[model samples]
Target: MKYQQINKSLFETNRAKFTTKMKPHSLAVFNSNDIYPISADSTMPFEQHRDIFYLSGVDQEESILVLFPDCPKEKHREILFLKETNDHIAVWEGEKLTKEKAFETSGIKTVYWLQDLGKIMFEIMTQCDTVYINTNEHYRANVETETREDRFTKWLKNKYPAHAVAKSNPILQRLRSVKEPIEIDLIQKACDITEKGFRRILEFVKPGVWEYEIEAEFIHEFLRNRSKKFAYTPIVASGNNANVLHYVENNQQCKSGDLILLDVGAEYANYSSDMTRTIPVSGRFSERQKAVYNAVLKVKNEATKMLVPGTDWAQYHVEVGKLMTSELLNLKLLDKADVQNEDKEWPAYKKYFMHGTSHHMGLDTHDYGILTEPMQANMVFTVEPGIYIPDEGFGIRLEDDVVIQKSGEPNNLMKDIPIEVDEIESIMNG
Candidate 1:
């Protein structure tokens, strides 16, 4: 982990919140994500499961957290099972967390080696009437691979068929959506790093620069600032590529007059900060580009204000659609007749700006939140609104992460990053 150790108190509070929602005599388990393989000898980087990291702050692979608040034995109430570390392993794979360090990393005192998991789980399974299994129930989730959590769940269910099964996703969805003060600070750190990267690109971007070169600059800034990697697969789409929506093939050359859509962010200590900023390849937007840019910015600003407490997520988007419709009409892209004759299922504005304006932003890029529920304070969301015009040869998107406030407008986490037309141009030309 390139990031500094998070305070154990955050994990402690998260575990307390989760346990409170569990049924009596129930034990919830969270597993670390597997280091996926790419080929025979190579493997994708290890990323700790966000659920376990949220509750226990255990960032290493092959780790497990179990919470049994009603356990008869006090020490067994909260437990951590970690891969055993020793001097030999330390030389080969760097320092793995020792039992003492595990206690410091997580607040759980009862730590055991991974080999003892079956024996310890068997004992706890007998005592608990219900077992809470962690599952991916995020709204946008379309998982194809069987994760470590899946295998562990299958094993546990097979071993203890009589135990009542319960889902941990619902409880986690609500709990993880709302940020704790410490979690908010970590996310701020990520947004701050992203600001540095965006600033770096502003000066580096120019005609003939490859999109991948811009991607490299962002990663360089992120790594130096302790962000392990991008919050998600970065989109460094230049010109017409931006209209593709999820264009990650950053191989195109940025033309002199084209706009480069940078849908990028940095992840610090497993927390995500999502941001999207489209800028001119030549450091100056044409009159038409400027008009579209300001329109999208207008929609983003208004949409952010609607993220106050008690706002419904679905209704918020509908209102945002209305805001965009007005902008599109002013842009002359949509006429009164177009909107009147448009299908209700897919609004007239969908022709240009299609994606949702915001989503929960936290540990995962598309973080967990029940969209049917009303917005709440401390919940973070990305206010991104874009106008894609392949006919005009460019796309414009401006996004900022914000915290829903108790009153007035939500707080913009990326406020320090330049977003205005003149500011971005000044920095690039200066």
Candidate 2:
């Protein structure tokens, strides 16, 4: 891991909170993500399963964690199963966590090799009446691939047909939504790294530069600063390419008069920071570009203020629609009749500002949070508002990751990244 070691207290506290919600005499299991294969002799990078990493701070593959708070034997209450390391693995794969190192990384004192899982699980399943299975239930989840956790769930269910099964996703969704102070600090560090990348690009961007060049600059900055990689696939959309919401080809050249939308961020210690900023390829925005940019900036600022505690997620978007409507009318993108006859379901603002203004941002780019629930303090969200004018040959978007506060306005994590029209222009031309 390129990032520094996380304090095990966060994981200990997370496990305590999760165990309290489990049914009595129930045991919960979490598995690390698999190293997926692309083809023969090649595989994708290994990413630790967020749930297991959240609870145990174990950041390796082929690991499992078990929690049985009501177990009759104290030693079996919390256990970690890790792949045993040998001389061959030590020489080829560098290093694997030793039993002592596992204890230091995770609060659990009991550690066993992966080969002992069957016998130990058999003993524990006899003592527990219920089993909690970790499943992916994030609102945006569209997983088609079977995971290690899924396989374990199937094996456990087939082996113990009489045990009651429960879902761990619901409890995790709520708990992961609210940030612990340490989590906020890690996220801030990611945002700070993203700011450095953005500033570097500001000086590097110029007319005739390929979009991929700018993408290269960000990754270069991120790796040197200890970030493993981007939180998500980056978007370096130039010109009308910004109109495509998920544009990531990054193959086009930035023309002199075109607006390039950079939807990019850096990740540190598995925490994510999301940001989007549109800048002129020629180092200054034209009058028309400046108008749309300011409109998007205005909407982003007002939408951020609405992210206070107790705000409803769905209704918050509705209110943001109203703010965008007023800006659209002012921008002459919409007229009086367009506003009056707007559909309640779609709204007139959809013509200019189409996507949702905010989403939960953390370990995952689109982090875990129940939209049906009211907002709470320490929950982080991204306030991104944009006006995509494809017909005009350019699009503008400005986004910043923010933390909902108990009082006053939400805290902007990208506070130091240049956003103002003058500030961006000066930095680009300076």
Candidate 3:
């Protein structure tokens, strides 16, 4: 792992929280993500499943975590099964976790190799009444690939059909929504890295530079800062491309007087930080561009304050819509009649600002959080609001990662990043 090792106490606390929610005599299992293949002998990079990482801090493939809090044998509880490693294997494929190293990484006392999993699981399955299966139940999930966890779930159900099946998603949804202090610090580290990348680009961007160049600059900064990769596929959209919310082609040449929308972030210790900043290619926004940019910044600032505890996720967006609507009306994108006759389903504000104003941002860019439930303190969220004007050939968005506080306003993680017109202009020209 390029990033520093996280304290095992965070994973210990996470496991405790999850196991406490389990039914008595129930056992839960989590698997690392498989190294996806592209073609024969070709494969994508290995990325550990966030669920398993959250519980055990195991960042390697072919690893499993079994939480059997009520096992008859005391040592059977909180077990980690890792792939067996030897000196020969270490020399060929890099170092895998040794038993003692695994204990240090995960805070679990008992560790076994993967080969013993079947025998050990069978012995424990009979001792437990219920088996908890982890599933991807995030609202934005559209997974089609058969994950390692999914295959294990299928096998477990077929082999032990008599055992009661339970869902771990609900418990995890609530637990992962609220961040641990350590997790928050990791996310803040990711945000700090993103700040460095953004500031780097502020000076690197210039008219006639290709969009891919800007993307390269960000990756360079992220890699040096120990972020293995971006939190998600970055969007280096320039000019009209910004109007398309998910623009990522990054092939077009940036033109003078055009705005580039950088929807990018750096990940540290598997925690994510999401940020979007739209800046002029020539280091100076025209009068009209500044107006739209300031509007989005104002909305972002106001929406962040509303992320306190007890704020309903759905209602908060509705309120943010009203805020954007007023700004749209002032920007002359909409008039009184446009809003008055606008359908509640698709308001006039949708013409300019189409996407949601905020989303829970942490482990994943769109992290695991039940949006229907009320917000809570220590929950991290991204406050991003944008106004896209295709006809005007420019769009503006300003975003910041913030932690919802128990009292007062949320704390901005990217507060050090330049956002104001004067600040950005000064840095870009400096």
Candidate 4:
């Protein structure tokens, strides 16, 4: 792993929370993600399955975590099946985690190789009455490729047809949504690195700078800070390119008097930090530009305050729509009639601010959380609001990750990253 070691207690607490929700005598299994193939002899980088990573703190491939909390044998209560390491593997590939190291990393006492998984699982299945199968259940999930979890579930169901099946996704959705303190610390580490990258770019960006140049600067900073790659696809959009919400084609010059929309973040130890900020190529916002920019900034500030304990995700967006509506009115982009006749599903604010105001943030940039449920403390979320004005030849967006609090307001994780116009301008010019 490129990043520093995460505490095993985080996984221990996560497993306790998950197993508490399981039916008595039920067992849950989590599989590591496959190293997907690109072509013959080529494969994408390995990423640990979030479910397994959440439960055991094991960030390796060919691993499985079986939690049979009510197992007859206490040693089988929490087991880890890892890929067997050998001298040949050490010479050819690299150091894989040995049993002792796996125990140190995961806090699980009993560890076995993948070859022993079937035998142990058979014994476990015969002892347990139900099995929890992990599945991808994020609301925006559109996975066309069958994942390792899918394959495991298929085989497990076929092999143990008599066992009662339960979905691990539902239990995980609620449990993972509420962050542990250690998980919050890891996410904050990612955000802190992202802040460093953003500040580096603020100094690097100037007139005539190409979009890809900015992207390179961010990656350079992220790598030096122990990040593997971007949290998601980066968008280094300059001028009108900012209007395209998912713009990633970074192949244009940043003209003076225009703004660059940097939608980039870092991935530290599989945790994500999402941020978006528009900056001037000339290190100063024009009168009209500053008005729109400050409006979006105000919206982001107010919208984040809505992310507190017990806030409804749906209701929060509606309130944010009203705030954006007023901002658009002030920006002269919308009138009373536009809002009066606007469809309830798609409000007039959609004309300028087309995307959702925020989403849950943590492991995945759009991390899993039950949107239908009320918000809870320690749940991290991104409060991003933007106004894309193609007609005006520029767009503005401001994003910050925040942690929901029990009182007052949410705590902004990106608070150290400069967002104020004066501060950004000063740093850029200084």
Candidate 5:
């Protein structure tokens, strides 16, 4: 991992929180993600499953974490199974985590090789009455691939059919949504890295620069800052391309007068920061562009304030829609008649600003959170409001990650990053 080792206390706390919610005599298991294949012998980069990383801080493939607080044998209560490492394997690949190293990485003392998983699991399965299986239950998830966790779940169920099955998603969804102090710091580091990348591109951007060039600049800054990669697939849409909400074909030349919509962020130590900033290709927004940009910024600022404790996620968006509607009206994009006659299902504001204003942001870009529940303190959310105008030949989006506070407004993590038009223009021109 490019990022420094996280404090084991954070993982220790996370495991405690999870285990406290588990049913008595239940054991919860988390598996590391597989190194997916691109073709023969060539594979995609390995990304540890966020659940295992959250609970055990084990950031490697072919790893497992088992939490059994009620186990009769004290050593077997919390265990880690990792791929065995030796001198020969170290020469071929890099140094994999040894048993000692695993203990240091995760706070758990009982560590075993992956080869012994079946034997150990069989022993534990007999002792426990219930098995907790991890599953992807995020609202935004549309997974089609069978993950390593899924295979493990199937195997466990087949091997121990009599054991009561329980889902770990509900518990994880609640626990992971709220940030611990250490987790908040890690996310802040990611946001700080993103700010550097954004600032770097502000000076580099100009007429005739390709969108991909801007993407390259962000990655360069991120890697140098210990960020492994983007939090998600970056969107470097220039000009009309921004009208396509998820446009990622960053191949076009940025015209002199066109705007570039940059929906990008950096990931540090598996934590994600999501940010979207649209700026002028020529380092100066035109009169119309400035007006639209400020309007979107206004909506973002107002929406962020609504992310306080006890705020309902669905109602927050409705209120944000109202804010956007007012902005669209002021922009002359929507009239009184348009709003009055608009369908309740899809508001008139949808014509210009369609996507949701916010989503939970943390370990995953669209992190885990039960939207039906009220917002809580320390929960991180992204307030992103965009105005996509195909007729005007540009789109404007401004986003910031914020922590829900106990009182008043939420704290903006990207506060140090440039957002104002004058500030962005001054940095670019200076």
Candidate 6:
């Protein structure tokens, strides 16, 4: 891990929050992500499952966390299972976490090796009547590949057929949505690293620069500041590429008059910071580019104001669509006829601005938050509004990470990062 150790108190608080809602005499288990394969004898980088990482601050592979609120044995209530390491294994794959170190990292003294998982779980299963299983129940989830957690869930159910099964998604969705103080600090560090990358690109981006060069600048900055990598696949779309929405083929040369849409973020301590900024390739925006830029910025600003307590996610996006409609009307992108004749299901704003204005952002880029529930305090979100015009050969979007406050206005984490046309222009020219 490139990042520093997180304070274990945060995990302690998270466990307390989760256990408070668990049903009596129930045990919940979280599994680490499988180190996915590339081809023969090679695998992608290991990313700890966010749920496990949230409950226990262990950032390692082949780890497991068990939470049993009604355990007869006090020491077994919170336990960690790590991959045991020996001299030969240590030389090949590096040193794994020892029991004492796992205790310090997770604040859970009951630690065992992965090889003992079956016996330990078997003993604990006899004491509990109900088992809680984690699932991908987020609103945006569309998983195709079976994950490590999925396989464990299947085995646990079949092996313990007599036990009553429950879903952990509901409890976790609510708990993980709200950010702790420590969580907010880690997210801030990610945002700070993203800020550095953006500032560097403002100076590096010019006419005829390859789109991949801009991507390289961001990677360089993130590594220097201890970020493992981008929180998600970055979108360094230039010109019409930005209009494709998820376009990631950064192979084009950025032209002088074109606008580049940067939907990139950095991950520090496994927390994500999503940021989007559209800037001119030549350090000066054309008149039409400036018009669209300010319009998206306006929508982004007004949309973030709606992220307060009691606001519904679905209803909030509906309200944001209305805001975008008004801006598009002024931009002449949608005429009175287009507004009147458009289908009710898809508004006239869809012609120019198509995606949702905001999504919950944290551990995962599209992190956990039940969409049906009302918004709550301390929930972090990204307010991103874009106007993509493929015909015009340009696109613009402005995004910022914000913390929804208990009252009044929400706090903008990217407030110091350049967003305004004047602010971005000044930095590019500096």
Clashes of 1: 0
Steric clash pairs (candidate 6): none
lDDT for model 5 comes to: 0.94
Shift in Å, residue 391, candidate 6: 1.6
Question: Comparing candidate 1 with candidate 5, which one achieves the higher lDDT?
Answer: 1
The TM-score of predicted model 5 comes to 0.99
337-391 per-residue lDDT for model 1 (tens digits):
9999999999999999989999998999999999999999999999999999999
lDDT of each: 0.95, 0.94, 0.94, 0.92, 0.94, 0.92
TM-score of each: 0.99, 0.99, 0.99, 0.99, 0.99, 0.98
Clashing pairs in 2: none
**Model 6: per-residue lDDT, tens digit, 1-430?**
7899888999999999999998999999999999999999999988889999999988888999999989999999999999997998889988899999898888999999999999999999999999999998887779999999999999999999999999989999999999999999999999999999999999999899999999999999999999989999899988889898888888999988888999999999999999999999889888999998888888888888899999999999889899888989898888889988999899989889888888998999999998888999999999998998888998898889999999988999998899888888898889
Off by over 4 Å in 4: none
Span of ten consecutive residues with least summed lDDT in model 4: 405-414
Candidate 4: C-alpha RMSD after superposition: 0.9
Candidate 1, overall lDDT? 0.95
Pull out the clashing pairs in model 3.
Answer: none
Residue 357 lDDT (model 1) = 92
Tell how far residue 175 is off in model 6, in angstroms.
Answer: 0.3
Error of 2 at 305 (Å): 0.7
Model 2: what TM-score?
0.99
Candidate 2, 226-295: lDDT as tens digits: 9999999999999989999999999999999999999999999999999999999999999989988998
On residues 46-117, what C-alpha lDDT tens digit does candidate 5 reach at each position?
888999999999998999999999999999999999999988989999889888888888889999999999
- lDDT: worst 10-residue window of model 6: 134-143
